[model samples]
Target: MFITLATLTDVPELTALINASYRGESSKKGWTTEAHLIDGQRIDNEGLAEQMEDPNAVILKSMDDAGKITGCVYLQMRGDKLYLGMLTVSPLLQANGLGRLLLQAAEDYARSIDYHTITMTVISTRTELLSWYERRGYQKTGDVIPLIITEKFGILKQPVEMFRLEKTV
Candidate 1:
């Protein structure tokens, strides 16, 4: 597999990949499924397009030998830190090391830009995901915040919190 910087042109497929990876039964094919927690779309096309258009943000896409996008990581420079988001791996292709590759790319990008740390938020209840990050050198940081309340995020049937995780790069 190879990783490349994504452009606005990749938004449509990225959006579809993200939604399918997190919002429904299709997500169950992967270990990163959030289908049980969130009932709506993970992210919409417009929002993804905006992220791609942002001058300071870049989404790194992972593709297989045949050039299919299998995973992606959204990254942005915020002050002295790199903010990471939407780390999505194709549901059917999860656990094939795509996620780890994308994460290493994020760290390399952060180091290239001289960021002191990389920070991200994970659903507070995602123990496995959190542990995965922890094993990769991220620390809990003991910080938790309520997830943003926005219609586009989802309709909450239960309260949710996001835990902050940081890794010094």
Candidate 2:
């Protein structure tokens, strides 16, 4: 397996991967689903493409020997820190440590870019996810914020809260 930077051209597969990993019934096969909490698409192709074109953004794609994308993590530098998000692995491929691998890659990437810290926000309701990040050395900063913007993403079934987690690299 190998991990490489994804370009805008990879949007189609990336979109399918992300949507399958987070939305709809397919996501239920894994522990990362938000299907019961949200009704609209997690991310569209255009948004993925736009992010790939951003100068400070990077989408790391993990692939097997056949070159199919199995996992991906989105990272962007904001000031002195690296903002990470959109981490997705094929639902069927979860629990095999792929997520950990991708996360480690993100940290290494941050270090390579001379970033002093890494930050990410997780949905407050996702205790499993929060615990996973905490185990990986991220600390909760007690910064809970409302997820108010709904255009890029969609409306939430319940009022959503995000917890900011940070780690010094």
Candidate 3:
């Protein structure tokens, strides 16, 4: 597998990959599924386009030998730190260490750009995911915030909260 900066042509596949990894029945095949927490598309082509428009942001994509995008992560320069989000791996391919590879790529990208820290938010109820980050050196800041319910993201089945986690890369 190889990792590289995503281009406009990658938007459609990225969108499908992200949604399949995070929402709906397909997502249930992976441990990262948020289908029980919310419903609807996780992200769309338009959203990916708008995010890519940010001059300070980039979406890194991982591809297999056939050049199919297998995983991706979004990173944006946020002042002195890098904000990381949308870390995704193909649902059927999870547990194959693709997530870890993408995560390491994110840190490498941050360091290359001279960023010292990386930050992200995780749903408070995702204990397993929080543990996964903690094992990789992320620390909770103890600041929990309510999740912003938006139609684009999906309708929350119940009230959800997110907590900040950061790591000095």
* Residue-level lDDT tens digits of model 2 in 32-118: 998877767788998889889899999999998998999999999999889999899999999999999999999999989899799
Alpha-carbon lDDT of model 2: 0.91
The model with the greatest lDDT is 3
When sorted by TM-score, best at the front, the candidate numbers are: 3, 2, 1
Question: Model 2 clash pairs?
Answer: none
Instruction: Tell me which of candidates 1 and 3 scores higher on lDDT.
Output: 3
lDDT-wise, the better of 2 and 3 is: 3
Candidate closest to the true structure, highest TM-score:
3
lDDT (CA) per prediction: 0.88, 0.91, 0.96
The model with the greater TM-score, 2 or 3, is 3
TM-score of each: 0.96, 0.97, 0.98
Predicted candidate 3 versus true structure: per-residue lDDT over 1-169, tens digit per residue: 9999999899999999999999999999999999999999998999999899899999999999999999999999999989999999999999899999999999999999999999999999999999999999999999898988689879899999999999999
Kindly provide the TM-score of model 1 when superposed on the true structure, using C-alpha atoms.
Answer: 0.96
Candidate structures ordered by lDDT, highest first: 3, 2, 1
